[model samples]
Target: MSDKAPKPLNLLDYHRPKRLRLKDARIPPLNAESKRCLRNLTAYRPSRPKFPYPQTRSAAVLVALFVGRMGDLYVLLNRRSATLRTYAGDTSLPGGKWDPEDRTIEDTARREAFEEIGLPRDKLKVPLLCILEPFLAARNLIVTPVIVLILDNTLRFPFSLTHSPLFSPPLPRFPTEPELIEVPYHTTNEWTYPGPNDTTLTTRAHRFLTGREAGGIKPVFGLTAAILIHAASIAHARQPDFEVELAPPEGQSREERIAWAIYSSPVFHEAYEAEEIKVDWAKVAKTAGGKGGGRSTRR
Candidate 1:
């Protein structure tokens, strides 16, 4: 890898070109299946989560999709290096926390991918499709999923040794008929957090089982699994094969619960404000209306 930084992406190349220079242009024309997936993602409007304070704990993960041998879309995944202390050897999308130099969240994703797997930063190689709504991770970080497509399926690069390109089951088949996921698919566990006036606010944890591997790669679960499920659902135009709703059925929505957590946490506030970022208390009050769990014990 070169010590020289990647060229900052220009605004003109910020997104996928709306129309090609020529209708018959075959500068490597994508197959019909790839085109369909791109169309679905581009048209999706994801719900955005709001907070009163600046999201200094923000991060972005790249959901790089490419057409597989069977003419179906597949998501590229990485196996984290075992040398890392956190989530070591776990399978996850390539991403990291937002950096001060990042001009946009999309740049954060692209930069992380380039650093992790030697993927090119040029939009000509990997084109943006869409970015999904922000997801609240157990760590209190707001994670945004950025979707991109690998233009050349056969293109090769000098990826890190720890960068394993695992092809998820074809998008259409997904969790519905995936041979990779376990039988029960996902299970939910309730977490109780101490709330104001000594009230107990409960949140649910959804964990999916990815079958064991001989190479010591941990199963995908938690935030990574949730992101994949959400992304695949959008790309394939369908819901997961198993139930996704977390219990108790009457509990506060995930976004509302997370907002309340951030709003109520003095520690989170002190850290966020320490960065000298402006706080929007009115929006925070509006979004974090309900009293619920402030944070999750697990990631």
Candidate 2:
């Protein structure tokens, strides 16, 4: 445990004055394509974790989408400052770890966006489209992707000079006539591990080359890339041009895999306990080990 004391929650930090409210948040009229995308996003239902998770280990990323001049959909992204200690110079969505003062996961996302990119915290200006299921990240952190639409693009911000903003169309777009939306380029690597009852579970990690002429932006890979793939697939209502990895026919589903990880991995189990949630010993026993279970570690 850390020697530092936990920060106290401040409800008023998230409140905005009534004088700042406006009848029109400067949101432009949505085109037909934008409307369809919005409808699809609004209807999406993301999966949840099978076991309880500690809020202290949670983080969020804002997948902010907007309409481009040609009515095509685009997402906002930034290259991290190279001076950062971890994942420096990487391309990522605007977000950070959960804060004690945040009232909810959505609040954590909104607060991080406001602090990172100067995005207004007002919901009317940038409305949320969806909150995706949690993804296990490095250091046993659970990252939730918050999807929101940037209605008022005219809002200016004093973004950090170290962070460079990059705007690109959502994935898997072809070079349509009279437009230069580049083709999506990506590659996947498969990973497998032994499971309960002599079974084997496999998953794929994806890497997307952000090659749209951004001078200093790094490629979107790992968690960031995977989240974008999911968001784009939902928004466009079509699968990616390339093959996407799925659980084996007889293996565990995505949620089940996460649950298995929490039960099997010592690091994750500690997180589960830190939340003061009781473990289902029966479920854990069912997935603990088997005759064919290998000793290889999972990344």
Candidate 3:
């Protein structure tokens, strides 16, 4: 009656109080699927028993998994900086020892990825794929490798000169050549050898052989190779199209040769150089010597 058309009955006015509450309410049960999934995934228990071994001796490894739309999968590996004291210039996965602040091994892996490669781990849709048994390397350190998935493509990573190149463009489009998917593994006992000057310090090398009988020398045998072998197997099982042919050892890249020279003492360096595989050390040095940044050297 106040000439405002009765103020257009407030939608809340005519409805019964009970009807208002029932508009969009539906109670969910305690054992819903969402709750079950969360419970199963969150339930993690470490099996390592307390021991007298120095805390400093323990380490952790992470296998960062990135899968493409066509189902092509690749593992993130990093070449250690020449300046690092341990495993300098060695090609290995992005991971390191755990810290007191880390809530779990997954946390350690995420933290190390961010520190070593400038990647934000939170951007990854990481799901705990599986856990490998702890293994000891010649360095006398215990390591655990946790596999996780990277589902987001929008995330960007920053690379430093010390760290090896990132798999730019996000690992070739899916349905990658079967040969590319195949990774070979060999016995650790056969590969582990003592370094030049130190009888106590030793290194293991993993030779990756492409079908063409051409390959690069990967100095990550022992635990690292074993981990890769296991990962390849897992990926193969999940993807029937993935196939790799085993071939004999081939050659080493110049970068790899240089890294071997720097990390391994003169004796090992000479031995590696004398091997059948030929490396262009001068070219490698030149490639690594450039000043231009933010671009990849890999073909």
**For each candidate, what is the lDDT?**
0.64, 0.66, 0.44
For model 3, state the Cα shift of residue 274 in Å.
46
lDDT of 1 by residue, 1-299 (tens): 44442332222233444532223333245567566666788777666445332336667899887766655676777778778878887778889887767877788899998888877787766777787877677677777888877766566755555645553533433454345454654566766776444456666555655444555656666777778778777876888666554443334455666566667766557655555444555566456554433332211
By lDDT, highest first, what's the ranking?
Answer: 2, 1, 3
Best by lDDT: 2
The runs of at least 3 residues in candidate 3 whose Cα sits more than 4 Å from the true structure, single-residue gaps closed, are: 1-55, 160-163, 168-205, 209-220, 235-299
RMSD per candidate (Å) reads: 6.7, 6.5, 22.7
The TM-score of candidate 1 is 0.76
**Candidate 2, residues 1-299: lDDT per residue as tens digits?**
45443332221223332221123445456567666777788777665343455566678898887777766677878778889899988888888888767777778988888887888887877887787776667666778888887778787666545665645545444222224346445567877777766677777777766665467667778888878877877877887766556645434554555556655678755554554455554554444333323222221
Query: lDDT tens string, model 3, 33-115?
Result: 32332233223223432111122334567777554444345566666776888776656777777565555556666788778
Q: Which portions of model 1 show Cα errors greater than 4 Å?
A: 1-35, 48-55, 157-169, 172-175, 178-190, 194-212, 247-250, 291-299
Q: What is candidate 3's local distance difference test score? A: 0.44
